[model samples]
Target: MKNNLTSQQMGKIKNLFADRVRFNKVERLVYSHDMGMMPEQVRALIQCTPDAIVQPISTQEVINIIKIAQEEKIPIVPRGAGSAGFGGSVPAKAGIVIDFVRMNKIIDIDKEDMTATVESGVVWQNLEGELSKRGLTLRTYPSSSDSTVGGWVAQGGNGYGGYEYGDFRQNIVSVDVVLPTGELKSFSGSEIDKVYSLCGITGLM
Candidate 1:
């Protein structure tokens, strides 16, 4: 598949997300593999050396990279911190490994509505320190200081507080994702009734 990538095509993909994204030697060395826990065969696979590490600064950059990866039929693996105990971050195929750590930004907070817009890399521990002052929390939170909101959500995580605040899946207000085909989309949040009505219809029904 890589053989089909013309010089021009390669340049385009590189530039598509170049503003804050990058392709570098150091990136290859670090993100080429994931940090998987011991005693699992899965660890061998996630350690595949990616040809490139794509750091998307925004949702749009994510979409652009996915589009080109799709064109090249490159395996696009999404990743955050090296915290997937299941070794999901291990890329079996050498392709594009997207690191979302740089996208960490708190876009907005609506105290009246009790909602906050944040980038995927917002650490669970960091979120707690900020939200605690407002008498609120992520509802579902990973105990680890380095755990990211997106990584936890992708794994459908649950916390000890699940019985009250709900599990990781339930606590999420929404998610903006770039599909493998390069579609930028969001679920929940403003798509809902614009209020935190826990008892109301799930809006999914």
Candidate 2:
């Protein structure tokens, strides 16, 4: 596979993410696809191989990456646990794949408000376990418990228990996103629709 990123661009990314940046061909290939199994014809047409994979552990680091992507005019693909088998996390044009695994953290749990402030990279099963300890549980979650919160939100928030409670959108209080222009903004209520199920086109959550 061809290396789409120049050395200088790679260096800049390295400076931001240090050892978290992955430029190896094999690693890029692994990050290129998700749980989805595409046919060879489709894969060939889409060029699923990503140029690079980066793991950003914080919102500020995500902002920095967006800035570099904007300056270099490269496609930025945000990814979580890659549990969805719908090509949502696959790279179509071979650019940077922003893996959010490192950002997984349960920031807070507000039992009074029945809300949890967590990083997008957090897995549903892990969250559920924590909630169970407090005699609480998620109203809805994907069938694949390993799926990340960000992935579920990006895919329209539909999952198990949605019929009884509601979709993920209804459960969200707010979301912090880094826009394509490298601007960090928070969305809530009706404004959340702007980025929900957008597949990371508008921003990185």
Candidate 3:
């Protein structure tokens, strides 16, 4: 995978992200394995390390990274906290692992409308704390409260309180995504169905 990226491509990413892009073999190794308990046989056969890892601090940065990925024809795996326990964060084709940890800001908490706009990286526990201060609470949460909001959604809706208030899908108001073509778009209500059905092939949510 490293061999697929040209020096110019590497330079472009380095120039844009500075210290946030990592290529060192040791550091990159961490992205290979996920939270799943992989069987020894399967683990022995797969060398899953990604080519590089990029941590974007904002939506604009994510868009920029996607644009670069498009130009370079590289696979971009969107990751948040890497707690999904599934291999969703592990790059299948060995390209860029776009870690969203740095983008974990709670953008807006609209108590009036009973909704919140958060960066994809915002953790459930953090958001819960924020809402609790205002006497509000999350409708549902996964057993792992440290999981990112976006991660839960990508893992096919979320959490344990579905019996009481419905699942993640039922509560979602809208989603802001960065498309593969580097276009930024927002989908709400029924529009989000298309994105969900595509399984994120169209964009990063």
Candidate 4:
């Protein structure tokens, strides 16, 4: 039979994996704080410290990391740029911090179809820069230069120009997500055309 981790066992697990995370003092400090100042959000998450922070470059790697976390019953927090005014990026249980920053890649741009496929970590500016050369744009972009495409999409972010260009919710053609159930799912493509399918969030983004 397998043994459940006691408090001390969990602490040891945290300490053991601390060395695996690559953030230096400054990086750690930046991540230690977020844009939010609300009591619960600010006090509840001050970067309690993660067991191990790993950067996964592909969907397969993300799946593997989540599987390990679930097998151990450790709390997992998935983060991209770790920027959220609501402190949503903060780790509540402080186990594995899977940073997808390194996964930045624009996989495909089908000009004929007017579709672009990008990795979760790809930055919106990068896409804008590339697409602009072709006189195309995502029609919407987050204001922050450091804002990431993945983070933007995850939060359903919008910009001031949305008044004319449209909100972030309407600009998104599709979305891919990994639910807490340990499954990788995509809600775009033909599945989006269905009136009954709501895996991808519906109504106001």
Instruction: Give all candidates' CA lDDT scores.
Output: 0.63, 0.89, 0.82, 0.61
Off by over 4 Å in 1: 1-10, 19-26, 38-47, 189-205
Error of 1 at 202 (Å): 21
- Cα lDDT of candidate 3 equals 0.82
> For residues 1-205, could you state the per-residue lDDT of candidate 1 as single tens digits?
1223356755776677665444555666566555554454654545455666667787777777767876778776677686765545656666677778888898886788888788877787877778888788666666666877667666655676878987655666776655445655566855533212221112101
Q: Rank the candidates by TM-score, best first.
A: 2, 3, 1, 4
Best by TM-score: 2
Writing each residue's lDDT as its tens digit, candidate 4 over 22-83 gives: 43444444454456654755555444455456677667666665666666787666666766
Could you tell me which 10 consecutive residues in candidate 1 have the lowest summed lDDT? Answer: 196-205
Cand. 4 TM to true fold: 0.73
User: How many clashing residue pairs, candidate 4?
Assistant: 0
TM-score of 1: 0.76
lDDT of 3 at 141: 82
lDDT per residue (tens digit) for residues 86-116 in model 3: 6778767778888888888998899899998
Q: Total clashing residue pairs per candidate?
A: 1, 0, 0, 0
RMSD of each: 6.5, 1.1, 2.0, 6.4
lDDT of 2 by residue, 105-178 (tens): 99999999999999999999999999999999998898889989988778876789999988888888999988
- How much is 57 displaced in model 1, in angstroms? 0.9
Off by over 4 Å in 4: 1-30, 37-47, 189-205
RMSD of 4: 6.4
